[model samples]
Target chain A: MVDVTAPPLSPTDRSTVRRHRDRQRADRAELHAVLDEALVAHVGRVVDGEPVVLPTLHARVGETLYLHGSSGAASLRGDEPVCVTVTIIDGLVYARRWFTQSANYRSAVVRGHARRVTDRDEALAAMRALVRQVAPGQEDHADPPSRKEMAATSIVALDLTEASVKARTGPPGDGDAVAAGDDRWAGVVGLATRVTGVTTCPALPEGTPVPAHVPTG
Target chain B: MVDVTAPPLSPTDRSTVRRHRDRQRADRAELHAVLDEALVAHVGRVVDGEPVVLPTLHARVGETLYLHGSSGAASLRGDEPVCVTVTIIDGLVYARRWFTQSANYRSAVVRGHARRVTDRDEALAAMRALVRQVAPGQEDHADPPSRKEMAATSIVALDLTEASVKARTGPPGDGDAVAAGDDRWAGVVGLATRVTGVTTCPALPEGTPVPAHVPTG
Candidate 1:
């Protein structure tokens, strides 16, 4: 659960929302909601003086955002300046004018220097948090990472202090002229991440049942 | 319709796939498929020497990718270097080992300098293409942008010649020991963007039929 009592998101020079300022949300709960619901985040950083963006699974434990990848990855090394962004497309907005057609979405951007987690205990906890994020109950079913496996991975944590959240919801914001026109249809088509079914491994037994945590449409 | 016969995707110095070389797809068809299926893209660029990533709608016509935003947007201004990434998460992979847990996704990263479109006709066409990309049949129903509306918008185009496509599909790539273990369940929970329903404007007349192109779950 997010601590809504925490301070509202402060706008820094870079974190200030210039485009679509109406959609910029200042509430910390909105930021937490976008981060907790996202399974993957695109992390951007300067690698060898060039910008690079990579998508990886992430977990938000309270105020800190944790990211993990192979230690050898170029983007995962050291305390480098990084920008983490998570976006969820909620629905497609259709308007009677081409300029007003858009999609409803929630996005959060965090800018900070990511510190590599070298402590043994902290890395273990971060790894567990990541697993519980994607697969809720599988953390108990799966075995913890071995010592060798833990050493091979790199966990980076970014403070969520300097972050910005922007969201657009509901139907299209069409003009009065377009909205009153009956010649065209204008509305919003809702979308969601539908978990259709589960596919077990071939080595599993023929009648192995799907886990309860696995979502099915 | 992607020209599968077009030349294969040639990686430039920056577009090279480094993290997971095994999942790097070289087929141009796969690249086009990923770009077409996506409705939103994260555009990354250096603003005041800090990396900023913004989510916006995108459209691909032939080999060029087009993105439009208000001229007031700081990220969309100028012909600066940019990286556009589109990712589609297909499923969640549950493994018996915590280290092997992952998600199945298809992603495309295009690195290049985006040129701002100033030609009136080209800008109008790009806007139409973008509207068609999100709501296919709605383009014919909606009215074109007025001269004042086009002046407020900025359309930027990025060539898809230099890009990288990475994808992971099927079940988890677990080790023999983990795969053979029957103590715990291991499988993939498939996911997709399921369009649930439509919500029309209150001003819409009674019985305004839903468009056929609108997806229904």
Candidate 2:
């Protein structure tokens, strides 16, 4: 989780929560929570006159969001306007009406210019944070990036200053229909990401055994 | 699944797959599979001179991808360039080196002009498909959209004509390290989305009985 002591999300013009404004979360901790939990972030950028969006591995390092990809990924360009968005789906809402059918999800949209990480120390720290963000203990277990590897990598940082956190939870909005003598079923079906299993490298001895840090099914 | 008979994905200049080009999938079924399994899509559009991306409920009907949201949502514009991207993370690759650590994910990036659905019949079908896309059987059990409800909703359709699918699978790339005198553990930690539970509406009578179509954990 990000530092809870940080201030609330900035009330910038672009920070206005879209869709159900009532569901907007004002706490900065809430913004960190959303960014911390989700794994893949969709990075959007304008290329020439067309819009390009791609999913990239992302992690939050304090107040900055780091997005990772190969050096060739066009969306990682420096000083370009970008939108990074992440969504964690909690469940499926089965409402009485098709129009009311929706998802229970916590999402964060961060809008800002991408600042390419050129400082070697900052880039290395961001890379470590990104790996730990996905698999917590692996940062210590895995080898740090070699000097040659770091030279070929590309990472861009976005300030978490201008962002919006919007979420939907609880029962369906049309639960009133059930209380109003309508027998139709309506509620939430919960969903979550679970570890299915673990497979050791085929090149290793068959009895190598899974590590304590790696999660298993 | 989309029709297996559908032609392969078009290879336009914009459709050229980005990042790890070797991971680009050529089959149209691959694109449909990625779109069908992922629950949320990041929709990006150029707002003013900047980019805005939001997570929206998206579904595929034949060659068109329909994104659903309230009419006030700005991304659901008519004939405007938009980018829709979906990602399904399969696992985490625990590689020997931080630079080699990667995610096993299937992602599809669709880019084109948004064609807002104005026809009532088209909108209704798109709505039905979108609901059913999330909860497979909910479309039949839930109430069909009312005339007034449909009027308040907005859906924009983008052709599947210009899109690219990229996927990474199998073991970690650094498996060779295991045979090269390095005993470090390295492989994949598999992941999947699962149903946790089903909660019936509280307003309904106690023991209301979840419908057979609803999944229970």
The candidate that achieves the highest TM-score relative to the unseen native structure: 2
Give the Cα error of residue B39 in candidate 2, in Å. Answer: 0.7
Query: TM-scores of the models, in the given order?
Result: 0.94, 0.96
Model 2: DockQ vs. true structure: 0.81
In order, candidate lDDTs are 0.83, 0.87
Output the lDDT of residue A72, model 1. 62
Q: Per-residue alpha-carbon lDDT of model 2 for B4-61, expressed as tens digits?
A: 5576774687687656778999898899999999899999889887888889989999
Which candidate leads the pack in DockQ? 2
Q: What's the C-alpha lDDT at position B10 in model 1?
A: 53
Q: Residues B1-217, candidate 1: write the lDDT tens digits.
A: 7655576775475676777789889888898999899888888888767777888899988888999755674668748788888999999999888898889999998888888888888788888889988889888888888887887788999989888899999887773654444546688899988887888865677688877876655
TM-score of model 2 vs. true structure = 0.96
Please give the lDDT score for candidate 2: 0.87
